[model samples]
Target: MTTHPAETVHDALREEPCEDAWWMPGPDGFAACALSSSARTVAEARRFTRATLEGWRLCSSVAEDAALVVSELVSNALRYGAGGGGKEPAAVCPAWLALTRQDGTVLCAVSDAGTTAPVVKVPDHLAESGRGLHIVDQLSDAWGWTPPDRSGKTVWATVSSVRV
Candidate 1:
């Protein structure tokens, strides 16, 4: 079995909005719950990702990669999807992150109010920010976007299960 840092996991769970975020029995013999949240800033995005990954008992390397992907996705939402003016906003739309486990894969999904789909651009050294999805494309086993039934779109990526 994979041994994780218990104290860190507990602390992160305490901060989640829902007690149970993602839960499913692992094919290998274990269960995991992944909780996610969203932020208007890159810093908050990183914090939320770190907390969720730690809570899920992801290894250091996987956690780091997941964090980076979350940062990019959240940043894109704040920039294009949500009406974040970068200053004090009169109102903010609900943005969220969700984790789910199915078929021995851990899926990380981010939802936002924007209808625009993410496009993977060819890597450009001079461009400032279009490379986010490109990186996600390379790291995740599979990634895509979907429109929610009510509103908004969800972009999701999958990671192979670590359970043993």
Candidate 2:
């Protein structure tokens, strides 16, 4: 998902998605799935991400990075998204994870039924949490969220690597 010089990351994030067909592994190069606010969601997403990247023969290092991004994105979706009220989400909150590769870049995007904008936090050294976005920012070529539409929002990150 190379961006033009004049177009910003936000612009890319806002691009219209074919909601029904986005996950199809057709000519556009993608894999996607539905997610819930379950505690196991992050782990499941990680495994899915790794398998998809491996199937596509992405560089191992890049696959690792993309997996991390997937972890953080899904973790955030489970923890704070879908109006979790700052605690474990008790109700089913729908979410989705999509991976796409083109040229040398692999893009990871997760959509959740939450409207909050993500923030990179300055966690205390001994803190047990709150570093998700920081890790995503460090690993990704670029990262940001799409403005929430009627349903919710999508947060995306990109990592570029050579094909294996």
Best by the lDDT measure: 2
Tens digits of per-residue lDDT for model 2, 45-152: 786677778778878898899999999998887666656343343244367788989966899998777767787888777999988899998899999999875567
In candidate 2, position 147 carries an lDDT of: 85
User: Using alpha carbons, what is the TM-score of model 2?
Assistant: 0.75
Candidate 1's TM-score = 0.63
Candidate 1 residue pairs in clash (backbone atoms < 3 Å)? none
How many Å off is the CA of 73 in candidate 2? 0.4
Query: What shift in Å separates residue 77 of candidate 2 from its native position after superposition?
Result: 1.0
User: 7-89 in candidate 1: lDDT tens per residue?
Assistant: 34433434543332333333342333332233424555555555655655666666676677777777776666654233222
Pull out the clashing pairs in model 2: none
Q: TM-score for every candidate vs. truth?
A: 0.63, 0.75
lDDT of model 2 at residue 73?
92
Off by over 4 Å in 2: 1-28, 84-93, 162-164
